[model samples]
Target: MPQFSRHSRRGRVMIAIGLSALLLGTSACTRLRTHQGYQVDKLLVDSVQPGIDNRASVEGTLGRPSFVSQFGEQDWYYVSRNMRALAFSNPKPVEQTVLRVRFDPAGNVAAVDRMGLEQVAHISPSGDKTPTLGRHRSLFDEIFGNIGAVGAAGMGGGSAGGPGGGPNGS
Candidate 1:
């Protein structure tokens, strides 16, 4: 029969506990960095000039935009964000860059604008039920509200219904 001494078994248990605690301690303070969208190169971006650069040249220099304006003035946006998260929590935007390049009718660059985290909006949802403007009713009212709403003919004032039961009430 195989046997383990008391001291050996105690040492194994102590080692296991210590390893588990060490794993958890390291994971608890782990900081994760996530990069999203276009990576900006200062030198390349600075070279793009208004009136001097057209659609073709801009595309060649900076590649395709992250997104184009859907409505109003012709504009291109290159968005970038640096998100940081710890453990399993939601990532928060630590840094953001939104570069807007506007174009004139001739497809030449009109203006260049840069924005940062100051423009980022943080919103908290209002919860499961959307707040709609109307009269509020209880659960019971919603379930039984339609009971006997119409007359015997289904419609408030109808003779009978389909078949011969029409305008003549045959």
Candidate 2:
């Protein structure tokens, strides 16, 4: 009887330990709060006044921008954002800022604009549609329209053989 009691006590201890570990592990995954101080310096870049500051002066004051235009050297973009989320929840953008600075013909700051989330439009996402009406021919047109082997097979001459080929070999 004493041995059984000892064994039961050991089982209870193991169960308690397992439950504690499970609870701690689950609770440890709580959502983490984003640090407000975690800000990027690029947010201030687009705020730079054109004509008032040259490239060197702008760089000295605001540092390098996040990205520059590849097609033209006249535009610069300064972008920064903060993200945060709970353990299982989706990460949400805490903040986002974009700056656009344009240089003039003389390579001096010409215009500067700063936009936040409120300024951006939330339009429904659109998919690309290849213009087939009067533009170019596509595989879809060849398969479904009036081209390709399938269309050729479907085309009938009213009779078995006149000017059209065989039914299966068209």
Candidate 3:
């Protein structure tokens, strides 16, 4: 039986401890980065009286919105998110908040709404096959379809051009 010396066993223990420390250190370095939108302070947001605050007051309090309504200028949105990722994986949203401010026709703040992560929707694609129009052709059909149809007439390489013909008039 091969017996390990006392020094060799101690060295092995030290190596194992070093590897464990390295793994723990690396894991500790994994941090979540918060990507926030227009930094909307809670106190300022709360102070924004709906009917009193107009576009100018809202802009001054919360700064410009993250996005305005695409259809019209009726709604403004302030969005914030926290994303986390490990190693080479894609960063995913850990938290999301969307504050919607709706304006009445008079351009005054009509309503103030807030949505949390619970409102987030995850959409999964249906399948690998994409729906395409027209009939699908087999590999054999694709390969043989253009076999002898290379240089025909108006295709620019037949015997009806000005370059060469069958011993007839130019």
Candidate 4:
């Protein structure tokens, strides 16, 4: 059998130590998630003319929304998201905004509502959350903090899902 020399053995040990250090250091480092903030729909919401808010005109004004009509064919939604997660169990929605525009049958602007982050209510992911035992939630409380689940129940699990609970399990 071949035997390793002193220098060769030391070199291998050093390489192993270096690799171990790197792996350990990387693992120790925190994994942070960075997200972009709420950017308004400058194309449509900002430049829209109330009187000229017809379907074609609104489409031209806003280019295309984050979403559009599916069933009723009268509502448009512009959405934006933001998040920052450093040492949390889950990422929180730092900021979120949705611009909802409703049109009359003639396509004239009927109503315009701007919903911001404050308008939303944080819920549980189970989509089956019952009332908690108490309400003295800390800053890092697990409950009453999560932005809720996406396709698990309340938010509706369809492509045409609205803000809250979907059809199957949002």
Candidate 5:
């Protein structure tokens, strides 16, 4: 059996340690990134009194909202989240917050609300089988179903009277 020299064994150990350190360092470097959208400070939100603040004043104080209500123009939402990912994995949200401000018909701030990650909902599919309409065909049926369908309407190239010619020609 070939035996490793003392120096070679030390070098192998060093290389293994280096590779391990690299892997650990890369994993440790994975950091959570915060994506801020319409950053609404609690103090600033409190500063704006509901009845006193109008749309213009709210925009001037807190800037534009992250999203506006789809059904109406009165509700504005400020959303923020922190997401973390490792290597090729998809980023997952670690923290989230949403601030909703409602405006009255007169374009005045009517109410303010806040929602956290506690309000988040996770939905998963119930099963693997998807319900489909109509009867399912077998593999062979799918492959041969159209074999004779093409020439069913008298569109085949062969003549009626003979193999390759019409009756008058024969």
Candidate 6:
């Protein structure tokens, strides 16, 4: 029987504890995979046929959409993104897909479009102030800017309810 001495056993125990801590510490560097928004399946996305499928049918097949257009046109958008992150940094998109489904007047599918990360707008703000082509004005100028421009102090401007306000100065 190989019996370990007290010093040898303590050394082995310390080595084991060190290895365990090293394994745990390396977990911080592990790449984390995450998903956001819609989970797209190639088969399901390809199955949606335009001109034949309606909103209900598309919803039934692909589930609820991520967002609906609120402006001039009513369209459905399915946004899917795969993100990767290390321990404590902001997650960056590994893969992103934006699917736009347009509808006709009768609610039938007009078209189906799919796009990738090319649609992403990386807008780093230039500064605290947004750049504009207009002339710069101070707080006092802005507050009293329009006060004297519209009508002079005693000019007979035909206003709605004042004297000389009407077409006939009655």
lDDT of 1 by residue, 14-107 (tens): 9999999999999898999999999998888898999899888888988899999999548999999999999888999999999899999989
lDDT (Cα) of model 6: 0.89
Which rank order by lDDT, best down to worst?
A: 6, 1, 3, 5, 4, 2
Local distance difference test, each candidate = 0.87, 0.71, 0.84, 0.72, 0.82, 0.89
Lowest-sum lDDT 10-residue window in model 4? 151-160
Task: Name model 6 segments beyond 4 Å from true.
Answer: 1-4, 126-170
- Kindly list the per-residue Cα lDDT of model 5 for residues 1-170, writing each as its tens digit: 23558778889999999999999988876775657566557798888779999999988888888999999899988898877877567788887889888999999999999898899998888899989999799999888877766334444545566554565545
Q: Give all TM-scores, in the order shown.
A: 0.79, 0.52, 0.67, 0.50, 0.67, 0.68
Per-structure clash totals for the candidates: 0, 0, 0, 11, 0, 0
Candidate 2 residue pairs in backbone clash: none
Off by over 4 Å in 2: 1-29, 33-47, 120-170
136 in model 5: Cα distance from truth in Å? 2.1
| Model 6: lowest-lDDT 10 consecutive positions | 150-159
After best superposition, candidate 6 residue 74: deviation in angstroms?
1.8
Local accuracy of candidate 6 as per-residue lDDT tens digits, 1-170: 24568778889999999999999999988999999999999999999999999999999999999999987445999999999999899999999999999999899999999999987899788779868898999999989876757555576664658887777786
Supply the TM-score for candidate 4: 0.50
Instruction: Name the candidate that leads on TM-score.
Output: 1
In the predicted model 3, the residue pairs found to clash are none
Every model: Cα RMSD to truth: 3.6, 8.2, 5.4, 18.0, 7.0, 9.5
Error of 3 at 91 (Å): 1.9
